[model samples]
Each structure stands twice: as C-alpha cells, then as structure tokens.
Target chain A: MELSNIEKLLEKYFEGETTISEEEKLKVYFTGEDVSPDLEKYKPLFEYFSQESTVAPTRNITLKKNRKSWYYSIGIAASIALAVGLFFTKTAPEPNHDLGTYDDPEIALEETKKILNMVSQYMNEGKEGLVYLKEFENTKNKFIK
Target chain B: MKEGAFITLTNTFKDKLFRLAKRLLVSNEEAEDATQEILLKLWRNKSKMGEYKNVEAFAMTMTKNYCYDKLKAKETGNLKIVHSNYQDDKPSLQRQLEAKDSLDWVGKIMNSLPEQQRAIIQLRDIEQYTNPEIADMLGLNETTVRVALSRGRKKIREELLKKHNYGVV
Candidate 1:
C-alpha cells in the first residue's frame, strides 16, 4: 500500500473512522519489518495497540487464587460473627424482676408495709381461733362436772 | 438471572474485565484487585444483571464504574497503591515484546488524558468496541462518542508526534 494511503487510513483511524478490519490492516502494516520511515513515528502507536490487544498481563492466576482465599476468609469471619451474635442473643437470660421500682425509698417502704399488714392480719385471725378454742374447753369441763 | 447463569456471565467476562481494569489502572495489581471487586459486585447484583440487554456491555460498564470509584477512592486516601514489578525484559520474549514499550507509552498517555477521552480510547481503540457500543457503555450519543474518540485520537497522535515527530519525520 502507498504511504499516502496508509497515512490517510491513519488519519481516519485517529478520527475514529476505521473499521476493525482496517484497524487490523494498520496493525499488520505497522508491525511489518519494512515499515516506511515516514510512518515510523506512528509505528509506535499502532504497535502499541497491537501489542496491547494481546500483550496485556495475563489475569494473575495467583491473584485469583488469593482472591478466592480472601473471599473464603471474609466468609468465615462473617459466619463467625453471625454465630457469636446468635449465641449471645439466644442464650442471654431475660431480667424478670423490676429492680428500678424498688430503687425508690417510698416504693420500698410501701412494699414493706404491705408485707407487715398481711402478717398482722394472719396473727389476729390465729389469736381469735385460740380464744374460741379456750372457751369451748371450759364449757366442756363444766358439763362433765 | 439464576446463580449459575450469573456465574457463567462472570466466568465469561472475567478476562475482559481484567483487561479493561488493567488498561484503566495501568497496574496489574490494581487491575486484579479491581477485577475481583467488580466480579464480587456483579455476583451480588447478578439478579439485576439480566435486566440489561447485553450482559457483556453491562459488565464492561460496571467495570468502568468500579475503576472510576477506585480511582476516586485512591485519590481520597481510602485505597492503597499496589505496584506491579513485571518487566517486559524477559529473554525469551518475542519481537512483539518491543510492542509492549509502545503500549507502556500509550498507557501513560491514556492515563494523562481526560477521563472521558481515556475511556473513549480504551473502548474504541484498545477494546475495539464500536462507536455505538461505546456510546451505550458511556451513555452518550453516538455522535458525541465519535467526537470524543476523534479528539482523543487526535490528542494521542499529537502527543506521539510531538514526542517522536510522527509523520513529518
């Protein structure tokens, strides 16, 4: 191909007007050993594109493996965290007593007074029953005499 | 999509994703990291991936977005820069090996370009994507894509020429 034609193609290329096949043509032309001197400067650009198409660093397989392992590590860490949270939440005991109310002196005093009142009531009832039992015993003795 | 379908999509596009990231980030380590993160995100949103007409395009778009976010995060000090030390000087390397030097230069130039231009060059030049496809990926009008690509190419050519006296030489 004429150098001028090649230059025109290059112009089109820079204008983003070349088709894939034309681009490939430019690559093959620039990559040839006998590239024209006038085209030498643009040589690097075409050569760069051609090389980049095939010469990119291969996907680092080791990196991929490391990533797989890293993911596994993250998965394990997340699982452990979730398990610990579940264990703590599931096993922790519920507080049944309302200690907050008893923390007030007046409430505690009222509770104490209620307990004392119940005790007095039971004691009075017991004393009355004893008195009735004593009366019954005296009446029975008089009848026997 | 089903899990298996999504896995298939990921498996299918992983290399492309890596390539795109590598092109964008200019570091293999960063590219790998970006690819993994992108894949994980795709996997997480695999169910919604099916909503797109083209899964590969969707994957590419997602990869680009993720790379942009990573770039921003790196700028904000939320991410660390991981360098790759792989040299092209291996003895057994082919004549195509010299091509890598050119690519390195291209990568540097692309990195120096504005974000939109760099993306246009990546999709149109490096990835060989059609203008329409690039438009879809970038959500720009096809004419806009064409204009951006032209401008990007002209800029790169200008740089290459200024550096090496491209055609005048």
Candidate 2:
C-alpha cells in the first residue's frame, strides 16, 4: 500500500505536477532506507537532488560595506573643500593682461625692431610738418619786426 | 531599497547565484567567479534595486544570463581562463565505484542534457522555484517551463531506468 503511494507520487513528480509538499514526501521516501524493491531505481534521482542542493560555495564572498550615508558626507565635504579652494585661488590672483614679453631672444629682437620702425616712421612724418611750421614762424617774426 | 536591504539581498541570493552558475557552467572556479561578478553587478545597480518587483528573480535572471554569456565566450575561445584554488564537491569515490548503483550516475545524465533542460532541472528540482519563478528566470512562460521540466525529468528517469535494466554490475 505504501509502495503504491510512492509510485503515484513518482508518476506525478515526473509529470511535474507534484507540489512542494508532495515532492518533499517523495524525497523522504526515496532517501529513506527500505525503499520499495520496485521503486529502488528512483532512489538515486531523489538522492542526487537532495545532495546537490546542499552544495555550497566554498569561497567566502567579500562584499564591500555600502556606507552610503558616510560616503555621501565625505563626497559633500570634498566638493565643498574644492569649491572653497577654487574661490580662494580665483580671487587671490588679480586679472593680469599679457604685456607681450618674449623669453626668446630672436622673438624679442624682431618685436623691438618692429616697434622702432613704427616710431621712426611717425617721427619722420612729424618732422616734415615741423619744418613747414618753423619756416612760417621765421617769416612772420622778420616781417613783424 | 534601504541601505541595509541591498546587503541583505545579496547575502540571501549569493549562494543561489553560485549554484545556478555551477549548474550552467559545470565548473567550480567559473561558478564562483560568476557569482562574484553577478554580486558586483548587483552592487553597482543597488540604487535601482527598488525598480525590480522581485529582486530574487531578477538576480537569478542575471546569474543565468551571465553564465550563458560565459558559456558562449567559452565556445568561441574568447574567455580568459580563470584560476582558483577552490575545489567543487564532486561525486564521492565510493559513489563512483558502485557500478551497479543507479543513484550515483545522475550527474552523467545531467551533464548530457541540453543547456536549457539542465538549467530548468536545476532551477525547478534543486532550487525548488515555482514554475512562474523559473519562467521569469529563464524568460519563458509557465507552460513552456512545465513542459520542458516534464520532458527533462522524464528523460533523466528513462536514462536511469535503462542503466538499471541493463544491469552493468
């Protein structure tokens, strides 16, 4: 009678109709000592399932601590420190325009020549006008005297 | 999810992930590494944990997908070989020596099964997940899960019975 009950459960189990409890019953019966001679072949199936489930990961899992709030605070502090540092660095230095200083001697010489040429050209133009002014002043003084 | 909730979730499902990985990959080092990788992924997505309705199912799905990808990579010879000192719980020597015993040879039958069937058997028989949960993990409907499970289970039984009737002992 008990053998017939196991047989029925085994049939249902193969058909995938056995509930968790029914399956548990089947497992208990199959793994127990004195399984029916007719049902001896089914013992390993249950034994394998039960044994396989007990297998654990031998390596220890190393999960990092979340510390979400702690990390958030640290992040905020770091950002604030960065903002403050940036503020000081930005304000401490006055905005200075480039005066066109050249470190290279060749570049300096070229720039000096270009400036001197511009100055000489302006001076010559001013001299030409001054010559006409001087002639006008000399004539006016003589005639008036 | 709460801060503590993510840790709690990983702690609960890590073993399942490892077991599922082993079932799919059939190697201990690969399974362990796969579990570690899956947990790391879950940790990276911890903020989105609340988005999943069933976190356990979601984690199982991830583990399955990761193992499949690993298997594919392995087939293509694109996988970097992972080395580890950890050993798997192999079938015992006595179990192997008992040539007449039908119970001990299930592992060989399981290994011969197709990947999908093996996965279904693992999730259903060993892990004891409901058909619906197995469906969600494998991305199949309940009916498909049931049918495949029945077929796989029956095939395993038939193979066992074949060995018994032949009496190799």
Model 2: residue A74 alpha-carbon error in angstroms: 23
Span of ten consecutive residues with least summed lDDT in model 1 chain B: B90-99
Write one digit per residue (lDDT tens) for candidate 1, span B44-161. 6666775879988887888888888878877898665665876655333343353346656666676778777878787777678888888898788999988888888888888666
Native contacts recovered, each model = 0.53, 0.65
DockQ of each: 0.26, 0.42
Clashing pairs in 2: A44-B103
Tens-digit lDDT string for candidate 2 (B44-114)? 88888779898889989999999899988888987566758766575456645754545458977886788
- DockQ-based CAPRI category assigned to the predicted complex of candidate 2: acceptable
Candidate 2 regions exceeding 4 Å error are A65-145, B1-5, B78-104
Q: In candidate 2 chain A, where is summed lDDT lowest over 10 consecutive residues?
A: A61-70
